[model samples]
Target: MSLKSLGAKIFAKIVFNRIQKWATNPVETQQKVFEKLISEAKNTVLGKDHDFENITSFEDFAAKVPIRDYEELKPYVERVVSGEENILWPGKPLYFAKTSGTTSGAKYIPLTKESMPHHIEAARNAILCYIKETGKADFVDGKMIFLQGSPEMQEKNGIKVGRLSGIVAHYVPAYLQKNRLPSWETNCIEDWETKVDAIVEETKNENMSVISGIPSWVQMYFERLQKSSGKKVGDLFKNFNLFIYGGVNFEPYRAKFENLIGRKVDSIELFPASEGFFAFQDSQKEKGMLLLLNSGIFYEFVEATTFFDKNPKRLTIGEVEIGVNYVMIISTNAGLWAYNLGDTVQFTSTKPYRVIVSGRIKHFISAFGEHVIGKEVEEAMNKAISKFNFSITEFTVAPQITPSEENLPYHEWLVEFDNSPENLQKIAEFLDLEMQQQNSYYFDLIEGKVLQPLKITSLKKDSFQEFMKSEGKLGGQNKVPRLSNDRKIAVALIQIQPQN
Candidate 1:
């Protein structure tokens, strides 16, 4: 084995030991983490303002600090953006990760020198934990390509600003750089399509063993590689075994990915955001991801069913129960206190603190009191795809609140297909039925004549591409909303060259 592989295995063993200790008693681990994080930041401007010095417990912290979103925290973020030192963190931030906003305008999230290690360490531990669990280290000896956004950064008030992928690019360790593909120069290409082509040319014949990126962009790269090599991805790189993906769920695209690769490979899911790296798939034996208890972020959960209540019950890690959907909140080393990150998840296992992403707080359809979320939509789509043997390149669903004066309001799916199904109507009917099976409220609405059967608007080829391009959101961590509460996006989608 190579020296690097041996060192990596040694590191994995050490990290796995720590993971075992942390997972032994999640409640205690989280309590200690919260105390440490709070004590470290209690002297910062935000901490001082919130009386963190006097806060003695989780309940005290929650009572002192109100749950806030980006808008509520905009003033502090703006201060940091304008070169204010020690406003949020101890000093000027190392960088700011610009979030691609759909509803609110783009947000600039601080990444401190202290917090940067959390992102790096969590990522390292994710891979290392996987190796320790599966007893595989050969993948580390070969090249791994990260299909990420442009690493090129811009300065804002002398503080660097870019996407999270760009920041991560700047921090790739020297040892791994030798086995990483696609030169740094190529990674700087601003246009995604052009950059993807460059990446295909650069890594087509390399000894690639692992590939990581958001599923959709990586799929584009794979397609280009297949056309150029005239071979399936598995044939092109027999060693390619691990796929690390985040930013979106991979289930809907799993079949298509396997079809392109000509085989199934081990994959790991990550719950990472601009705010923090929250969790990762730790064991193939378990169903959901294991939350990182010792990471620099302290977590809280507010029941999603009562998220908007004036005084919603806030629960700590000790209080969380399996099967309850919760809106995740965090107080991190980056000076965010009780900040709501807008993602929702449900605990599948509380003993070791494992969870599955349920949906985003903003991405839900409830036009007729039958609320449906991303998880339900993804499951229904996966079922339809599996049974129908079709492929979806991209899709989004929105409530058709006013179908017509005579027609009852219903859901409309705007889908872009790589391989169109034999009968689009049948697929649509199947999805509708699947959704009904998932949500009884939706089923009742349909049966009570309050809602019409779901409708399908098979989008013209490249319709999503045109829409994203027109909006200047065509690439780099931007994704179409899987579900929306209103028809604003759906109406605009229909105008984007509908096939029908």
Candidate 2:
């Protein structure tokens, strides 16, 4: 091993022990975070508006500050955007993470000086934890590609604004600068397809070992690399061993990824967002990402089933239970107080608080009362694909309330296959059976004749990529929604279909 690799090994062990203190004292760590956030922001406008000076406990904070998503909190954000100080956090925010929103056009999420370290450190620790557990730090000596957005930033008011990935690109550690691949000019390519072409040209012969990105976009890169070099990714980058990803569940794409790489690589999962870094895979043996309790955020859980009720009960870490799906709410050092993050999670291990991202609260098919979620569909499809030895490029689930035929409403899965299966009929039945087994409401609906078994609609290859490009969200943090309540995305997909 090189000197750098040996140093990383030593650093990994030290970091592991430091983080273990917080993991063991989850409740106490969260309490300390809560107190620090309240104390620090008590004089700010949002804090004053919510009477934070008098707040002494989680109950007091909850009662004083109602939960608000980006849209609801935009008034304060707008003030900050227009150069106001102490509107959200203490003074002016260091930067704004610009991301596309659904109902709201573009969202500008603040990243404060106090909060930025949480995002950077958690990512670093994910690698450290992996190295410490598996005792494999040799990848540190080889080329690493993050497969991120353009690092070029545009000034919004006085703050630098860009995609979160792009903003983070500016912070690559000095040590890894030599090992990081794809020259800066290539990374700045505005167009994703053009960027991938540039990346292939630059790194096709490099000793790449670690690759990180959203699975959908990274798949595009792998396909391009294979097309150009006529070699599987594993052969092209023989040293490549670690795959890191977040934003979407990797299970659905596992088979396709293994085929592209021609081998299985050790992987680490992360649960991060524009607001804060929440969790990361700490142990190779663990099923869920270890929740960052001592990070600069205080977490709350509202039961997903009752989230829409007039008044949903918000529970802290002490009150959360294993296996119960909850909409994750967070109050962060970045000045977001009781913010509803729109994501749902299930605690797989509450001892040290490990969670799996279950689904998005707003991203589900509840057209009927079946209320099928992202996790259920991904799990059901994963099983069916594994059983049939089939692999898919991309897929999404939406309710088809108005079928072309006189049939009952059903969930329509638009799938883009890596290789078309010969027995699609059998695969459909298997997928439907798996879905029925997982969801009781869906099973009851099917038995009551209110809904038919799920149907698969095969899409032309690269349909999702084409869709994302047309929508101006081809790469970076953008991802196709896995589940939708309505047929908006489904209708859009139909329009993009090629005519014979």
TM-score: which candidate is best? Answer: 2
Flag regions of model 1 displaced more than 4 Å. Answer: 102-104, 498-500
lDDT of 1: 0.87
User: How do the predictions measure up, each by TM-score?
Assistant: 0.96, 0.99
Q: Write the per-residue lDDT of candidate 2 for residues 129-177, one digit (tens) a residue.
A: 9999999999999999998988898887899898788888888899889
TM-score of 2: 0.99
For each candidate, C-alpha RMSD in Å?
A: 1.7, 0.9
* Candidate 2 minimal-lDDT segment of 10 residues: 491-500
Range of the 10 consecutive residues with the lowest summed lDDT in candidate 1: 491-500
- Report the number of the highest-lDDT candidate: 2
